[model samples]
Target: MDVSGAGGLTDDRVLLGRTSTAERVADILRTRIAEGYFPPGARLSEESIGGALGVSRNTLREAFRLLTHERLLVHELNRGVFVRVLAVGDVDDIYRTRRLVECAVVRGLGQPPFAVDGLAAAVAEGEAAARADDWTGVSTANIHFHRELVALAGSARTDELMRGVLAELRLAFHVVDDPHALHEPYLRRNREILDALRAGERASAERLLARYLDDSRTRVAAAYAQAVDDPAGSAG
Candidate 1:
């Protein structure tokens, strides 16, 4: 699953055109990071990745710089860049932002008979992934559900913001010891929110989302802290 080279980067969406090569590299790298292809604290090897993707060092460096600016990667002098490992404070702030933006999106919804087909599909996707024991897929489906929920507002800027935020959130998830325990409980909450939205109960959906994010933030932060505290844990 090393998604580098012709096999990985040559997809229609990932094609590197003559222009925007660096931007395309950034996009590809960003997606890979979000997908947990590169987990938290994973060192990105410029030489191997650049060679695999047929990009120059300059292009790869620029892409890394872009991701670093996004707070997804950190640069350490004499140590190279690695994926960011979130602190407890970072977790709280991320969820606070989520509660603000996600709840606001629900509250801003227009009247009844909402267009929530995408949300419903995402919920089904999570269920299917759970049935298949694909926890990663479940996490992805959860992200999709929230993305679809935000789409209710129809704002490109907000969509872009959540894309980054959720990607960061995924970094925290990548460090958890019990993926099933961390993610399984939330699938039901996703369904409940989706049902509420479909029923045109915006306030109820927003409240559910607020509680969900708050609870998720607390759970994820505690798990991450425990991992960091336990030397044998995989926080690295």
Candidate 2:
């Protein structure tokens, strides 16, 4: 769904009187990237996108700058902008952060002081997506589950950071050969972690989450390695 329109710029005045059009455009483009509509290494056609979205070139460039700062887009001297493809080191760092933050949150919830509703909800979402064979949905719910787990800490700052981390993580997932095979095994693991949290088994939950992050990092790193070793045969 190309969400650009000739009238969207003018309509923005009525929809959000004081909001910056460039910011709105950035949000739209960011969502598109996150949804994998623009795969890793795919060139972003500024002229075409600007025309489609009915925005000036300047506005589109601002949007590109914003995403670039978020590490979602990268610019090369002659190649314009493309969605970032995560390297093995990037994968390692992301998982390291996840383990440090998420495991700490789980460890603190020793007696279930916080509500498990968010965690439970994410688990249910993953389960439903799995039943429907929606691998993308499953992957989304999986990230949501981790996000919700971070929310247990009640820190807005951590939540914001995890959102960016998960978005980058999704880029890695977008390159995997089989979404179903990649994500199917984790649906049950999410449930197990949720159950541990619900049971107030803090140690058990932390252990499970640590293992999950470790496994995911290893799998994604291998996928990236394969892509680099054999670009022609790579899924991305």
Candidate 3:
């Protein structure tokens, strides 16, 4: 019996091989952390997680280090790894930077001289994810859309900073109770923002994007406050 056709092997092992143990462990840990399977400040034990992922402690440690550098995990001397929680000031600074970066992207928008098909595709994906009630997918697509939006600024540094901001925002999303409520209404708003850009109304798009950012900040802060007040109620 050929194990190859049974999803066991392939002609190109390089292409069909399973992900590296470290990469797989990192991905699992990242997804769980993002999905709130492990709440902020939850300590992670290498031995237990290695057992769960069928990986060595070394591999799991590598994964932990990766996430720690990404700001998703925190490692302290004499203390093990724990999920990083965003402070109120961190959230405030995140939105302030987002407003500056994203508004600039919108302000630079104009008709068809640049290809925005990628942005359009990301918006479509986000809308579909929202409809499917896949909050994680919705959040991922939302980040992609805005990242592409900021990419229009033609600055690699801006793009890198935006990526970090988006990851921190994902942490905020996990902390909030009603994730859908925070993202659902923005589907139309994103479309409208794109429409304004396509119509060459750069100023209008900038205004709309600024307003959207403000509203999102308000919602996130309210949710964070509620989460703080009632810990058990806000399980992402």
Best by TM-score: 1
Q: What TM-score do all the candidates reach, one by one?
A: 0.88, 0.80, 0.72
Off by over 4 Å in 1: 1-18, 231-236
- Steric collisions counted per model: 0, 0, 0
Q: What tens-digit string does per-residue lDDT give for candidate 3 at 3-96? A: 1121111122233136656655665666555434566767777665655555667877898888787787888788788778887667777899
* 207 Cα displacement, candidate 2 (Å): 1.1
Stretches of candidate 2 exceeding 4 Å from the true structure = 1-18, 21-28, 47-59, 110-113, 232-236
Better of 1 and 3 by lDDT: 1
The lowest-lDDT stretch of 10 consecutive residues in candidate 2 is 1-10
Give the clashing residue pairs of candidate 3, or none: none
Task: Report, for every candidate in turn, its global Cα lDDT versus the true structure.
Answer: 0.82, 0.78, 0.72
Residue 83, candidate 2: Cα error in Å is: 0.8
Candidate with top lDDT is 1
TM-score, candidate 3, is 0.72
| lDDT tens readout by residue for model 1, 1-236 | 22223225435343666664776787777777776778887877777777667788898898889888888988889878788988867888888898899999999999989999999999999999999999988988888898888888999899878878888888888877778888898999999998898888989988899999989888888887887678377542
- Rank by TM-score (best first): 1, 2, 3
**Model 2 has how many clashing residue pairs?**
0
